[model samples]
Target: MDIQYVDTYELTRAGQEVHGQAPIDQFERLIEDLPEQADTMVSWTVKGEMDSFGQRFLRVHVKAAPMLECQRCMKPFEWPVDSHNRLEVVNSEAALNVDDAADADPDDAIIERILGSQRLDVLALVEDEIILSLPYVPKHDVCTLLSEPLEEEPDGDLARPSPFAVLGQLKKD
Candidate 1:
């Protein structure tokens, strides 16, 4: 299915929500980070909300399980992704400066800011969030490769001498 775009201002004012499931392959940037493009479906929901102060914002939620290569084992494994973010729609680019905005208003410190857009791409936003949620180095708690026993050599030599054995001999010298 094609990704949808929405008018940030109108959606927030009307308190509307857009939701859909798109295949993982649809997200180009996300595909580059994955081990392989599997038939994974990413479910996403973008809900517009207005605070009591009349400020417009968007609540983005995404969920998916994509295959990632384990850094430790170099093997492919499924990584669960469930993330939510609140983005305050700002009228100008200056307001997008989180540090400045947070300094001016303490409330802005907690919530992220985004430039208001008439054609806000929901798929891009979802992909960005998923990427941000990913670990810098993806790895399993206990890699199967580590737990499994090493195979014996063709000559039936199962044990290899430790590299540290040379250090032990030097100690005697």
Candidate 2:
């Protein structure tokens, strides 16, 4: 299947919007992170606009629930991914680097910069967003390991005596 490509600059200049739904398998890089090939689909919408400063920008939104392995329990769980990004289209990479350096606080900077391209890979962009949205250590709020019933220990000699038992014996003596 052919991956989707868009002319980012033109899309922003024309104020166009495109939306699509694609199977998770289509994202090659994202597939590597998944535990299995889930029957999941990712839905995305890209809207282009010119900001108040006449700067071209693309607003990308993506939503998907992919099965990811939990780091703590080592079990597969559905990870909900919803990401929204505003990409400022820069004429050159130099401009992007300059802006990045000038932004003192990344937390305060809401808009991200990307080099404007005539044929920007849309799937790649979506895949990048999905990966960014994922947690560094994917884990459930409550790991399943804690809920699983532990095997019952055998009683009698197999069970080790408690440390305080010696103190109890001394007290009795």
Candidate 3:
């Protein structure tokens, strides 16, 4: 869902009293499109403030139950994930772009944008947080049903290169 920037601005101006639920369909779309396996049920609460840095910031706490395929056994398993995120929405395109380019830190960029904006997109902020919270490699616990060992190769030397390794060899000039 496209969160109304106007509402965000109003909330900030009115002492940042915003609180509510955001649609999760957009987040679901992102998970579906991910190259790796992932599924989650997420909910969040957003609190806005003007930080010491003089930027309008939103502090978000998200709770989720993520389902992912085990890397070792390739079976699905569930894991709980709780994340806290801070975001900033900047007003001017110039300022936003400059902040985006100046530093690669997500938190810093977010704070810059929030403090600089009169309005913010709540949905966008939530989506960004969720994306950031996703694990790079999700694995089940050792005792989980999905955990298992793979069979050893018939050859005693399991580290040997495959026949296809010749594909990388350069032809003689």
Candidate 4:
């Protein structure tokens, strides 16, 4: 089914938990965002919470495997994607725009200001996370073509110049 939006405020307020699996095919933008796709689906679980400061928070865990085209050999490969996110829901974007926003602690949960009646486009969020998880240049760890191609020799043996021949001439001189 199509997952467009969710009432994040209510879910967070009631401390609700949401978990489900959906086919990635529903996400058109997500389908084309990466180089390729393997027949797969995205599974996710979102849990609500309230911090000591009475701030609404949501923890999201997503898992998926997207087919990726190897940049080194142009071969299709599956890239397992598992992402976890913790978000704090704020009343306004002003909180997110504060000067210290950029300096927020990495270990701290990311702050997400409420948007449009506290409704969240969950699918969009998943798509974004998937995109961020993609490798800049997808490639296999060990590519088969790393070594140079073997050159064809004349027959069983091929003779050329010898280093000793030049040394022999020098010795004669």
Q: What is the C-alpha lDDT profile of model 2 across 61-136, one tens digit per residue? A: 9877677899888888877777899888899878886755465566637567888998998988999999989888
| TM-score, predicted candidate 2 vs. hidden true structure | 0.77
Candidate 1: Cα lDDT at 105: 59
**Whole-model Cα lDDT of every candidate shown, in order:** 0.79, 0.79, 0.53, 0.68
- Residues 41-127, candidate 3: write the lDDT tens digits: 345566666656655556677654445666666676655545776656556666655635465675454443544445556555666
lDDT of 1: 0.79
Stretches of candidate 2 off by over 4 Å are 1-3, 100-110, 147-173
Residue-by-residue lDDT tens digits, candidate 1, 1-173:
36489899988999998888777888889878578865667888899999899888999998877788999889887777779899889999887764655355575567778788999988889999999888899998668767666445476443664424422332232
Worst 10 residues of 1 by lDDT: 164-173
RMSD for each of the candidates: 15.0, 16.8, 15.5, 18.4
Candidate 2 pairs with clashing backbones: none
Instruction: Locate the minimum summed-lDDT window of 10 residues in model 3.
Output: 164-173
lDDT of 2: 0.79
Q: Of the candidates numbered 1 and 4, which has the greater TM-score value?
A: 1
Scored against the true structure, residue 21 in model 2 reaches a CA lDDT of 72
Candidates 2 and 4 compared by TM-score, better number = 2
User: Tens-digit lDDT track for model 4 on 34-140?
Assistant: 65565567777777777677878778787777777888888887777778887766666776555655676775634454442356877777777777788899886
State the lDDT at 34 in candidate 2.
Answer: 79
lDDT measured at residue 58 in model 1 versus the true structure, 0 to 100:
96
Query: Which stretches of candidate 4 lie above 4 Å from their native place?
Result: 1-3, 33-36, 101-106, 109-117, 147-173
**Candidate 4 or 1, higher lDDT:** 1
lDDT, model 1, position 61: 90
